[model samples]
Target: MARKKTDQKGDRLESIRDAHNAEKMARTTRMEDYLEVIYELIQHKGYATTVDISNYLNVSSPSVTKMLQRLSESGHVNYEKYRGITLTEAGVAVAKNMHDRHGVLAEFLMMIGVDEDTANRDAEGIEHHLHPETLKKLEEFVKLAKNQGLFR
Candidate 1:
């Protein structure tokens, strides 16, 4: 039937959309992890190295190198072999957004009685998947809770 065919077409479209979203999310999460590590390392040490990134990410050195190459190609970083790594302007923007989001999420979880370590770990797990609107609302909630003296 034409109706049955239409329904199947709709289902196929929805499946495609879901697959696209999943791939986007995976890329975003991976990129966020790398950017956050680079940002944090640079903050602490004024530089980031492949070995440091590998250690922080718990990934192999070759894996970090490969990803860094891709990031460089994408204009997200300035990377040279055996030299320090630095984020490009676009990379800094993404890294700063991610940093703010991570801080708010971890602070919220801590206010809810989660330990610092656990809150940070959990924030990293879910940060890239959060909708911007949801993160905004959560940020406001954390602020309100702070104003109310709701947690230590």
Candidate 2:
């Protein structure tokens, strides 16, 4: 029947959308983690090696290499065979955004009486899921709290 075929087509489209969403989420999370780590390492050490990233993330070297390759292909980083990793401008922008998001979340948690360690831990988990509008609101809240001496 025509109706049955239409329903099947709709189902297929829905399935495709769901799969695409899942893939995008996974990629976003991965890129966020890698960029953040690379940013920190480069800030501290002037370069980020695959071994350093592997150790920092507790992932294997090969895994880090694979992800770094993907990141390089995505124009996020410049990867060389044995030199080190460097964030491209796009990568730096992403890393900076992620870092700011983490800081705002952690500060908010601390302002609300969460311990430093717990605040950092919780912020890391919460930062990736927040929308831009939600993060903007949070930033405003933190500013207000700071003005009120709530963080002290």
Candidate 3:
């Protein structure tokens, strides 16, 4: 009986670990943060540089260099010295997804009367934490509110 109890507990622990791993995979990783910022900068301004990214993110150039190297190795970005960086296909997809999440959350926050700057700042943090289902609902609600001419 004790053997069976131990086995059951082990199984439960494994299941919990698996759930945590899945959740971790579902959300963005820290590296993704850099990629997302580059993606946004590229989209808005047509190019991104190490200095601009460093300034916007408030990180050192050395730190950004380390991450850019990792991202390049992971096939998420193409980095070169004295030249701008660009995202690969996989990187673009991830960046676009992150951007969409930020857009939806920011719009939702603004719809509820949050100021533009605060909403954007809050959305940047909230986007990483929101689950897919919750983000979907928030997007839908924001769309509906916009249709109703609410919060204009």
Give per-model TM-scores.
0.83, 0.83, 0.78
- Global local distance difference test of model 1: 0.89
Compute the lDDT of residue 38 as modeled in candidate 2. Answer: 98
The alpha-carbon lDDT assigned to residue 70 of candidate 2 equals 93
Clashing pairs in 3: none
**RMSD to the native, candidate 2?**
6.6
The C-alpha stretches of model 1 lying farther than 4 A from their native spots are 1-27
Model 1: per-residue lDDT, tens digit, 27-119? 557877898899999999999999999999999999999999988988889999988799999989889989999999999999988999999
- lDDT digits (tens) for residues 53-103 of candidate 3: 899889999989988988888889999877779999989988898889999
Per-residue lDDT over 1-152 for candidate 2, one digit per residue giving the tens place of the 0 to 100 score: 99999999999999889867875865578778989999999999998999999998899999999999999999999998797899999999999998999999999999889999999999998888776898999999889988997776
Query: Quick one: best lDDT, which candidate?
Result: 2
Task: Give model 2's TM-score versus the native structure.
Answer: 0.83
Give the runs in model 2 whose Cα sits over 4 Å from its true position. Answer: 1-27
